[model samples]
Target: MQLLLVFQGRKLRITVILGAHNVRDREQSQQRIHVRQWVIHPKYSCEGFKNDIVLLKVGINTSPPAHLPKPLNLFLVPSGAECEVAGWGRTSLTGNGSNVMREVELKVQKEKICQQLFKNYQPQSMICVGDDYRKKGVYKGDSGGPLICNQKAHGIASHVPYGYVYPEVFTRISYFKPWIREQLRKFSLQDLPGSPFSD
Candidate 1:
């Protein structure tokens, strides 16, 4: 098993690990596929956290792919739906990240809650999640993680306002389903020789 280290910025490096339980563990079953390329959404806005999804092209591998939850369920996710968010991020305000992957259960908040919290809240593109009273949520290092509801990935952890005390915002996957499909189709056709989509 190999670990592919990809640099996001001059100071930020990311290691995409597959089939691994512990971040520090070098288990024989774990495999790290090298990322060949990545594409960010053209309409992404940093200020408002709109269209904040990225597609990555990785090298082909023999490891069986993990079962991904189907996108676009054709039904709306009701408010207060219990969901889970997992990450290797810090557990506390001043604590360091854990070595093992961890997850926390949070409920989806109503659109009005986010509207009251954020000036730029866009319900069409974002999902608000967390337990405000309990002060439980995705912390500093949990950004870009998935908000899994009923086994489907509904959101991507986007930002937390003023800290984790308030609800965290996520990029709604369902809202951008068309964009995701278009990107995947483009990437799939890129490998053909002399194709216009070729990298």
Candidate 2:
């Protein structure tokens, strides 16, 4: 199956690794895929942080064969739902980034909470996720990671307020499902025979 990936616009990197557990280990099943193209949201902005998402196309070449994870369909994530976020980011307020991948369980906060916390919070496009006690949350270098809930990617880590605050903002995946579908359809056609963009 062909894999089309999505992530936060600002997190576009040179490459992505699949089946990676430890950041420092060169696992036998791990595959490094170079980023080939990035389709940023038309309305995305650095200041307001609205529509802070991007579609990614990657070039895959691996020895011993490698396959990407199954793409999860977007779905509505309920408030107070349990979810997980993983990344190789800092574990503490004063610690450096970790060499091993770490994951933290968080709860999806209500839109009312986000609206109260952030001036630019958009209920239709953003999700509030973190622990109520401000204990569990994504740290630096965790931006653009997936907020997985119910076996699907319900959101993309958008931004965290200064001082590592609780209830971080995330780009709601369900709200952009139409735009994502359209982009995938458009890109699929671009790879068709006789298309100038086709390889």
Which candidate leads in TM-score? 1
Give a tens-digit lDDT track for model 2, residues 165-195.
5779989877887788798788788778999
Q: Write the per-residue lDDT of candidate 1 for residues 1-199, one digit (tens) a residue.
A: 2224444544323346787778898988797776666778998878877788887666665565333434555236678899999998888888998788888899888888899888999987888888667667888788888888887788889888874446888888877788778977887898889998665
lDDT computed for candidate 1: 0.77
C-alpha positional error of residue 42 in candidate 1 after TM-score superposition, expressed in Å: 0.7
All candidates: CA RMSD (Å) = 3.5, 5.7
Q: State the displacement of the C-alpha of residue 170, model 1, in Å, after optimal TM-score superposition.
A: 1.0
Backbone clash pairs in model 2 (N, Cα, C under 3 Å; residues 3+ apart or in different chains), count: 0
TM-score of candidate 1 relative to the true fold: 0.84
Q: If scored against the real structure, what TM-score would every candidate get?
A: 0.84, 0.82
